[model samples]
Target chain A: MMLISAIILIIMIVILPLETGRFLERFDKGHQNDTGMVFLSGFLLQLVLFFPVALGTMFFIRQDNFVWCTRIYLILSCIPAIAGAVCRIRKLKEKKPAAGPERKAEVYKNTGEEKNGKFRDAEKTILWAAFFIILAYQLYKAVTTAFIDGDNTFYVTQSLIAQQQGVMFTNLPYTGGPTSLDMRHALAVLPLWFAYLAKVSGIHATVLCKTVMPLFLIPFTYLVFFEIAKRLYPEEKNNIPFFLCLVAVFEMFGSVSIYTSERFFLTRTWQGKAMLGSVVIPVIILALLMIAADIRDKSNANIKTAWYLIVSAGIFSGICTSLGVAFSALLTLGGCLVIAIRDRKPKLFAMSMLACIPQAVYMVLYVILK
Target chain B: MISRLWAYLELNIETVKNYAGTGFLLLIYAAAFAYLLISEKDKAKRVIFVWIPGLTLLFFFLPPVRWMYMKYIDGSATYYRVLWLIPVAMTIAHGFTRICEGFKLIGLPVAVALIALCGGDVYHSVAGPLVIASKAQNEYHIPQEVIETADIIMANEQGHRVKAVMPLDFTSYIRQYDTDLYLAYGRELIMRPDAYDELYSMLCEDPIDVEKMREAAIPRQVSYYVFPKTSGFVKDPESCGLEKAGETKDHVIYRDPEELEYMSGISYYYFTD
Candidate 1:
């Protein structure tokens, strides 16, 4: 049963979301983007779409019928997953013309040039080794650190409540009563969602929370950072991976004088706040850079694409942590304003405002509910 | 205090020392930044490099912003500081290529030193802590015992609607057996508390008030007292109408009223007035 659940989880969360993202990427229409990043961008979208649906379902379900509610929630979520898979298949078939193989070859030839200094096979091997090793080391750190301390209890207990009781924002697990969670708890509905996923996936919530997320999200985080790097240094695209390896290696290089990202990323990357700080915030910054690039290049379509991603990122941030929506709005606005003022793009300022709508809406609704 | 800022400077340096093996990676990071500021001319890139860290540092220093944050925000200064993390690392990584180009002769040495520094950090921050945490049976570093004890309490409860009154730390939210079995003294900002302070006061009342303890606890719906292995506060609950129901390595579960509460009395004072 657990194995079956794990397979279902992978299909629903990992595979389906990624495929949906790929299908969504086709909507970029003529934009020249890779299959991988397009698939990844789906994750942010999945979070955006999944948060509302899952929370809405949890909101109305009978409080005691946790198993039934959870089973129903999983079935409802599969609708999108299946739809995405079908859409991606249809999209792929549409893209594949009668002479598709020849066109694919032509496209490969067009994109074949090694932009960064061409690395030898050994150099590539070394870089890959470094990436994997660093991921493993951080995994070790996260898995080993005791989750019994600090706010971990809050996170773990909430996930357990979700898994065992099928409760979300209702049965106040820590205190155990029927009070709607406070403003802080109300905003943090992701762990409950995760608990739902863990139950359906058959993976233990602890393993899913501690090991799986850091192992996957950290590298995915590196991808986001690499995107940021590429934006800043467009000419040095090839060097991004090696630099990312350094990021992996220097996992503990935070200054003790002040709190740094490593403290959370290494220790609490599984928690929502850490995800907010490490992944969501950085992705927002990346979207800002993408929007800036699009504006500078005068590409309206790419600018629209950038906006979609930023708003999706905003929604994810809002769902991930209590302070995430506020931080995202402030940070996205602040970043856009500074960049716009520098580039003299007043219109970019309006677009940046548009980016905050998802978070703003999420924030206002939660406040109203409270 | 102004001195306090500089005082943490040394602590920060120690953070580098312990985490980064005396901050060689940091020195490389500094070198990369200094090299870029000197040689690189892209203003946008320079701003991107400093953007997150610069804003975070400003937020850290600005008293008015801190005041506003404390007023509006509900998180910790230490944690929110996580905002600056990847930006700092990315900046270091971003500037590294420039640093390599700027300092061509010793670039390999810099790379070699960085890899070594990564190893040291992994040892101290990752591997070493994990080793210590694994060995932490008594739980100076990890509280696996406390966690297991929670499971024991839950298993013993067997889905019965029971609440345990114990030391705040023992009966915390972390000590969970099941949804039905709740601890009386939960951690902060809990929902629907069941009058813990009054019951705690009764447990510690002079000369060990037995009838009152039973009346206040079990009647109020608190069914158990999760005492520690060491007899400190409620040394002998036998005199107070609590019999040992279960025992774990770290805790002793004592059921109140010995058996089913025939009367259990009206807990009117336990709730309203």
Candidate 2:
């Protein structure tokens, strides 16, 4: 099943870029001006890059050998992609023509006019108030619940055991089956890393580590909302940053409440922190969409950014939960197809297939391992 | 009547405290909408219309109003009784905003009143389920003996790899130990009287077909036997090889080398029989 999926994914990726290129050519010829084409082109590009990695891992790793190899492949693929994309984006920015004097004057004028607005001041006050209120509440709940719950202790102890064993799968007393430990879930890494740091810092770190997890969601929530706000209202960019901050506050509080109210729902000792990791998948997908939007805008034509987003999304998807990565990729592809159909851009539609190649590869690897 | 009202109020207060942040955000949104309406700024009104309703609905879904309602509502709180207001509140909020934006408005105090009414409806819906769950947890503390035995096993065990017999679904306890423990009778199989009778007959019948019984009883390897206080064999010790290992106020633990021998000896008996 995985092999077939991988092959289909690879085919989609290889074909998508060609389609996107065709769409761009058409657009240049004044055949398409719609934002839909841009979305399709970016989506296809994401598929092509992601599916191959998923497929490769699926084919190469046997079920017994899959978990660690999948994790390794995901991390290896993601880091370089993120680094490469960042470099390419930086290079692209440097190469762009500096804003003309007229554009700079306009930017200054807009900034000055915005500063004089009453609503802006009110919005800022609201945003800050919400942020602090949510942060303080989440922190309080996390602290109060940490000691009372045994699940955190179990996770910390198991993580320590995994670290000592050198491989995540071996010498772990808790896991009964032969499945790979490293492949368990990405959230496991955070507590394990905290355990390692505590060993170095000479402080009892388990409770601190568990307590800090919901707090991390505060920043993660902000990033996701920021990305969404940017995508939804790019021209009204000044308002987006503030709006994102408000959304972040709301999400942070919601997450904290859910965590405290039903601790069992969010984290199984074996699963580590499923909620935080799951939320990250959507955030990463949104970030990829933002990069696609940036590429389409001709603001910076960074192929590296495209590659980075695809690879990082693949790795994060692999690490978090196989299902989560699969769902996010599916959503992105679906979103892309909608854009393509709406815009009548065949090339962009094709590129969306290409962009999802790494995810396909990861899925393939996951199946073989399973 | 007063007590019932107090119970309802207590539930609402807890729900509000639990979801304080969401309430705070709704208040901000309400304030923002009020400002947009009063100022008569057409652009701001347009933006508020586009964003606020969707945002409110999204918040309602995420903190999950339905789940909250289910948690708090007693048997008395029917769906028909409360569900009518969901759309009504939504429509009222929508209409009030439109009217306020037009400045042919029903005054500032009325707008505030409308927002409060709408917010109150949402709050009531969410409070229904929170009360129910809170009451259930308060009422259903696990039996003390069960909890004590579980604690002892948890403390002594290294991981969920310990084997022991339990009267109920003890996987949750085994999970705490991080061990794979097998029940003497299969957890689900024991639930059926016919299955348990067949299993008991096989284990206790004279000139006991130990081989057949072992096959029936031990799906996984047998590590320990937990004989409840009520078991006839445990009450009259002469009928079985199992010797008392320990006893608690509600239950007793038994260990028998012959039982292990019986299980291990069954493989040989299988071919001979």
Q: Top DockQ: which candidate number? A: 1
Cα error, candidate 1, residue A288 (Å)? 2.3
Give the Cα-based TM-score of candidate 1 against the true structure.
Answer: 0.79
Kindly report the root-mean-square deviation of model 1 from the true structure over all alpha carbons. 6.4
lDDT of 2 by residue, B1-273 (tens): 656556655554454445433454345445555544455333322222323333333433432333444563223322121211111222233344334432322233454443444333211122233411111111111234544554554444432334455554332223232223333443234334555545544444544443454455455445445545555431254234445555667777554445442221100101011
Error of 2 at B45 (Å): 19
Best by TM-score: 1
Candidate 1 residue lDDT tens string, A1-370: 8578667867766786676666676577633345445655777776666675655555555444346546765666566667767876686687863332232211123577653333444454665566677677766656555433446556766676667555665555554544454445755667766777777776766557755656577767777776676567555433555677666655554423224456566666777777877788778777766766665666664565667767887788777786778787877787777678877888778878887887778777766765
Rate residue B58 of model 1 by lDDT. 52
What C-alpha lDDT values do all the predictions have?
A: 0.60, 0.39
**Candidate 2, A73-154: lDDT as tens digits:** 3344344334434543564587874342332221333456433366645554664565556446545544443222334334
Residue pairs that clash (backbone atoms under 3 angstroms), model 1: A5-A201, A6-A201, A257-B12, A261-B85, B154-B177
